[model samples]
Target: MPRFAANLSMLYNEHDFLDRFAAAARDGFKAVEYLFPYAWGAADIARRLADHGLQQVLFNAPPGNWDAGERGIACLPGREAEFRAGFSQALEYAQALGCPRIHVMAGLAPAGADRAMLQKTYESNLAWAADLAAKSGRDVLIEPINTRDIPGFFLNRQDDAHGVITRVGSTNLKVQMDLYHCQIVEGDVAMKIRKWLPTGQVGHIQIAGVPMRHEPDLGELNYAYLFDVIDEVSTQSGWTGWIGCEYRPSRAAQPGATSSGLGWLAQRLQ
Candidate 1:
């Protein structure tokens, strides 16, 4: 298997999220992810994992004003204070949860903001967090979420993530090239993965589909062919890591996601 992890946040309406996590482990998921784990104490979640022997793959740091469609806040001007306070909390949450990767979201920037200033702020804060995250042996990564799903959101392209990763200049900081978002923002998903794979700083990977942003196979992207490309990369030296099935389920309890993704992911790992 490719080392799959469940995104607990997306299953909000279906059942108790933590319980769902426990069930995932029982169903044989070795890894998992969460969008926001703030409401649940890390100790409790950690205990649940212990009860099942599951590893948490990654979790998104809290996005400010989530209901307001503010996807993130890392690059905003005059919001450094909020970012500092909020990010501190997020890091603490990650630490307690023993999560290795934190996905930094670049929320919407203020109106009429200076582009140069925003970029500077993004780079500085990322570098600063690199030091802080080092304390926990954790990675701080910026993700390029698609603007189609999150209208007016900042950091909507892989280029933006790539530029910031280059600027931060830290082994602990990198791009979260979401295959789903990349498919929308730009095609050639597997090819880009090959190109960026060498950086070793593309800390994490995620996927859904192109237009619908639903299940991975339900969209135009050919996951079967994509999986083969990834398998090739795995064999090459210096580029291999986890690729999350960060897509929403087409239906409740799709075992194929767990079973099927694992079947293909196992090849990629080899």
Candidate 2:
């Protein structure tokens, strides 16, 4: 069976961020992930996790100046210092929270900049991150976000992510495969899953409705079939990782909308 982790950053918007842990637990989630945990104290979040019996599965390293639209700094030429500091802070939180994975976002590609330079910086940063994370027995993830959702996102294809991981040459480095982005950037998600899952380079997976970024059940892709595919491939490859529910609730205006939209999850578990 595929383990599903509620993406607290996107789901359970009705409740405060800290309270989302309880909401997800009440909805039967055993694990959870989110974009970033910098806003709250790690101890506070840890307390919430303990109270709710939920495990923190994933979260992103700080993206530079989010208010100014800097998605990430890992690929930028002059931001290596900032990136390392941010990642160190993220590691501290991960230790405090007992999370196993941390995602490092590749910043948007600056127009008129050398792509090779950006790739070098990104690989270097990832290499350092992976080395540090390996010492702590944790993994560092790089995701291929779609251009539609995040235009100019340096990493946008599975091949590119895997290629970078190969060059980085660290066992602690892996790809965070978001099926929603995969479907948009490259079709044939099931085939992609089958091809990559067995490689053991895929560290985590995420899902959402294509085109609308809503619940997985309301999308062009049939999640039921995909889940079965995942189950089959996982059984064969022994890939035991959490599938993150990273999508917006269709009924966000209503109370308990996130929980209400989880019928697909219940049906799958049944």
Number of clashing pairs per prediction, in order: 5, 0
| lDDT tens digits, residue span 65-176, model 1 | 8886777778877778887777788888787777888887887767788878988887887888787888888988888876677776678777768877777778788787
In model 2, the runs with Cα more than 4 Å from the true position are: none
lDDT of all predictions, in order shown?
0.73, 0.96
TM-score for candidate 1, please give it: 0.89
Model 1 weakest lDDT span, ten residues long: 255-264
* Model 1 collision count: 5
Task: Output the lDDT of residue 119, model 1.
Answer: 84
TM-score, every prediction = 0.89, 0.99
